[model samples]
Target chain A: MAAIYSLYIINKSGGLIFYKDYGSKGRMDTNDSLRVASLWHSMHAISQQLSPTTGCSGIELLEADTFDLHCFQSLTGTKFFVVCEPGTQHMEALLKIIYELYTDYVLKNPFYEMEMPIRCELFDINLTQAIQKDRVALSGR
Target chain B: MQFFGGSEISPSPPTPTTAGNNAHMMYVFNRNGVCLLYREWNRPLHTLNPQQDHKLMFGLLFSLKSLTAKMDPTSAEKGNLGVPQLPGQGCSFHCFRTNTYKLSFMETPSGIKFILVTNPRTGDLRETLKYIYNLYVEYVAKNPLYTPGTPIRCELFNTALDQYVRSIA
Candidate 1:
């Protein structure tokens, strides 16, 4: 089964910084992806306000009949999320690895601007490798 | 455990317990996007006015429904985004969970949407939503004085809903 569908990274202010579709069945155009990202950002914020408790963060997981979206928001408010097949295991760990790759290859590069779209070739290579590794490991199991 | 040595990034917060007053609010929207009912049990913050809040919720559901349908992995016919989908026409989301709350949604074949916002740690609510739908059918839908597509004004329905929600929350 195709475990992962896509990955999205949104800036703190709800801008789409990075989006990649990982050979998923349904493909979204750039415009559609941007719209979805911002919509998710707004929904996340609204969830916080809708919460009746204090110190509530935004949405972490959205489970649909066909797909599941898992989100991880860093302390700095940058959001990393993955859309995967429903019941995909170890997504949280996968997201954490992706975040680490972002820090190493994207953030460490001097040319990478803050809050801008990630354009680092090294980051792309590393991310692809990490995801491929995950796929191989999962399939092996 | 300590993967990032000095970065501010940390693991997500621990999941909250399902105990206590988990139910925060609920919304009942008719087929035409009219809010048939809105109830609040434990909301602390109010960012938008009542009208705006209802609209936003409806809009979110609209976009999510289309997105999910468009992103259906098994289906080959990819429809245009933002197009309205009939209830149960495509793969739809059951619920979404944040750190604090979970939003459970169910749309009947008749197009009535039942949304329940509860604590994030709450378990599957498919059965609970169905039970609520049954309540609506009995008290609100069956009542002769209650008109369809109008805001729910039946006291019997409200009382029963409150009692049920209290039991779950």
Candidate 2:
């Protein structure tokens, strides 16, 4: 089964708060991650600026045949990213859990530097458990 | 300190009330060496304590959060309390401990009313909210020892709350 390679968090202002890549790391670097986060943030702001005024608040998600990109925003304007393989069901639930974890762990952590790499163990543990639960439900295990 | 459910532990003193009163009060029940507080909402909050006055409501809010674990448990605690539901909907579970005091707020769905859990004597909500939110932002949210989906009580959350409350009052 294809596994999640990493997770990243971007504040609304186009700053990176946390980023991490698992072993099978794609062609990504800290600089690339930061640039991507900034680009995404700018694009999101521009999209909202050009929106129909009432139809969309910001860029919700980007998807293709092979990969899926999910984003979530808090009332205070923080954003979270979840990249997953195509055809993953319950992506919304996964994002919700991740958002909750961020609020309770990363954002709540005293030592966490805003716009830095996400190194919190809780984030990893919860993500793993959440993925496992999904797999179990998916496989009826 | 024991951390449960992504919240910090507060060292603020308890606000005691007689079981006879209908107003909400914070309760802490001791078992073995651990203490558990019972948290709930009696009604909706009518207004946000003006941002300037939130410091006074901290301790009461923490006790409520500690008791309820931040879960809106009005329905779950209903049978236990033998109290009927509020007639419209459920109470929003919001409880947290700050560098100052523990604070809890319950706003009605309509946003017209609010219930502030506070020390029966001081009766402040603004202080509590500000302090608790600050704690979440500063200590609990920043601690590396904290894990998501698990309850919270890192030394940072506790020490910050204690120091804030003591310094203020």
Candidate 3:
């Protein structure tokens, strides 16, 4: 529910098209974020390749006490990551809504070319709505 | 008026054109009673009257022929955008039109060009564009079929544009 501090989208080739860190000094450096995106992209690809033939591929979840990382890989090799506080509830629904946004606003936008980072205004607006809704729900209002 | 995406406007007649370039033209059609086309860039358009509180829907629409024609000599004005159907034939174009002024489009090689038909006293490009951007976010976008360059026909978009137009009227 806390506004997403930042978001990174990694292409199949591991290039970063969109990156933003809001309201924090711990802003991820562009180079470092790119490197991390690329690394994660490779890791994500490798994980998919190593998956048992019958099931879905890639790293679906990675967690620590302070934070959690969620990766969603589309059929075309684009990966969407959501890093949030570890204990956030209803994470599945939240991620589903976020993925819907990625498809509708990001992928569908003519301005947003595939395998590139997101830059569409609609994408951010919908994302903010989804996150804000979750935050409000978490607050028990 | 600002140009964006795959639409083009034909050249206006020899008179002093609302669009700067002579090549700018409008693809006009009748719906209900008003003429419609994709709003072009960099042209003066009609403004809504304040007391009437109307909504104006405005944006860009593109065609593959226009896209290819400007880029490749072999493709100018030829239907080559690959869609089997005529994309712009009845598409609802949003323009703010008050009795005193009307907004319109001018076609160019780059994208759909905008032309304003406003009384000089009641218009400002920056403010109009800002209002458009807000409307786009609040209304056009909320609907699913409002794709860029695709003719919009949803009642919601019409209602919103009408509201804006009425407000200014």
DockQ result, candidate 1: 0.49
lDDT of 1 by residue, B1-169 (tens): 5543422332333333444556888999998889999999777667789998898888888877876777666666767777788898988999998766789999999999999988676799999999999999999989999989999999998999888887774
Which lDDT value does model 2 have at A118? 72
Shares of reference contacts reproduced by the candidates, in order, are: 0.60, 0.00, 0.00
Q: Where does the lowest 10-residue lDDT sum fall in candidate 1 chain B?
A: B6-15
Q: Write the per-residue lDDT of candidate 3 for residues A1-141, one digit (tens) a residue.
A: 353444556667878766654332332456656765676565454433322121324455443223445665555666666655554566656666776778788877777667656778888888777777777788774
Model 3: per-residue lDDT, tens digit, B13-98?
Answer: 13323333311112322222123333332223233332121112211123212221221211123333223323333221223222
User: Model 3's DockQ?
Assistant: 0.01
TM-score of 1: 0.88
Better of 1 and 3 by TM-score: 1
Best by TM-score: 1
Cα lDDT for residue B119, candidate 1: 69
Ranking by TM-score: 1, 2, 3
Lowest lDDT block of 10, candidate 2 chain B = B28-37
Error of 3 at B106 (Å): 66
Question: In model 2, which regions exceed 4 Å deviation?
Answer: A3-5, A22-25, A113-117, A139-141, B1-169
lDDT comparing candidate 3 with the true structure: 0.44
